[model samples]
Target: MRKLDKNLTETLRKTKYFLLDLDGTLYLENKPIGDMKNTLKFLRDKGKKLIYLTNNSSKGAHTYVEKLKNIGFYEEGDLVYSSGVATIEYLNRYYKGKSVCLLGTESYRQEMINGGINVVDGDRADVAVLSYDTELSYEKLCNFVRAIHFGATYIATHPDVNCPAEDVYLPDAGSFIKMIETALGYTPKVVIGKPNNIMGENLKAKFSENDDFSFMMVGDRLYTDIAFGKNCNFPTMLVLSGETTEDMIPSAEKQPDFILESFNDVKNYF
Candidate 1:
């Protein structure tokens, strides 16, 4: 095996779970980046768990699973964990039994229901969850805003303003949050996704028995991915294959513990 710098090698060795961002981190749109399949397989071959973590809640985990598997990035034991799933974890633990008004895609709504959450229309909601609601409509927005005005606790799934695409960027959950703020002059009380600890807490719980398990967050976005690792108290690795470039590193507020040209490049340091 090729040996890396002491710290990088140690971080790689110690990390039992790698929380990976999907869009810009691993692949672009529908294709894997630079032998990504081989790199991930090498990690798993060494017994490292790969968790395809994403902030987009517009789709369910199965959707991502299908995408990853089709692209050959997925293996039998690998997992896809999304902000929507993490939000469900948060709701069950903190607001269990509460009527939740969700401004999200129908698939995500089903995910919440499957997690034992009581999904209600915004009019009757005791809590409102804002996710990447690709199915968002005027009626849904009005109801979600009204629920918050009526004292429903507001929570956002993530803070990403835009999502990367093969061509153009699309508005994400954070854009919706900003819209709500513009309309209601209020924001969510808690954001459940990246740069937050809820997802990290869920991971901790999932791997609780293994106290030796350390986490590492790898991605392309500095604010979301690197910041999340910092929030989760995990080592962070920034990859250049996505949104961020080498020039953007110096001015970034969230500096990663390691940097690489692309995620597949980790094999060099191993």
Candidate 2:
């Protein structure tokens, strides 16, 4: 564990719930970050509730649960929330019964359908949703653009431009949005994931009734992860095991309350 200054140490003592980022902060690719298992245990032993929060909309809750369990970061009864869930909730609340055309993976589309969203074909849509489509095709992009041009309302699951995948970065929803914006000259009216308060609302709906309990957001990226915590009014902890580095912090618009090398370093807090 890395040593912490007095202020950060005090801040950690006040925190009760941790909304954790999975891919970078917990594990890089399929490999666990150093000493992560014991670090998680230490937090649990100290009565800190762990909730896995991810902006990756490509996979659903079940898939994430399987992945987390396989990587040994997930315990029984741990809650996992994804951008897809928040997007579904957003659709249900504001656009219930509207025909939605999803530009995402088949699994993400199915998850939308399972959540009682009215996902339909492009031609039949009244709204168009964009997400992290790992299986995106040129045809799908064209269809999505046409749908929006035809007056369909636009919404995005998250605004992340890139997704960290081990040694590489994959273009995420925001990148696709940029292309579409360039082509169609429009952007999504609502983006429901990180840096937006919808996720925080979802979190508060599940937990956070007690004033005595404080919350923290722990993740790797400054824009999505740390920004999310700031938007939610939760203290942010930046970990460098993934998208960000120490050099990236100075010019960042949103700075984290604490910074650590990896999840292994979090052990010093508790």
Best by lDDT: 1
Stretches of candidate 2 off by over 4 Å are 1-3, 208-213
Residue 182, model 1, lDDT: 86
lDDT of each: 0.87, 0.86
Q: Which lDDT tens digits does candidate 1 get at residues 40-143?
A: 99999989999999888999888999999999998999999999999998898899899999999999999889899999964767899999999989999888
TM-score of 1: 0.95
What 10-residue stretch in candidate 1 is worst by lDDT?
206-215
Cα-lDDT of candidate 2: 0.86
User: Can you give the lDDT of residue 89 in candidate 1?
Assistant: 86
Q: Backbone collision count in every prediction?
A: 1, 0
In model 1, the Cα lDDT at residue 66 comes to 92
After TM-score superposition, the amount by which residue 205's alpha carbon in candidate 2 deviates from its true location, in angstroms, is: 2.3
lDDT of 1: 0.87
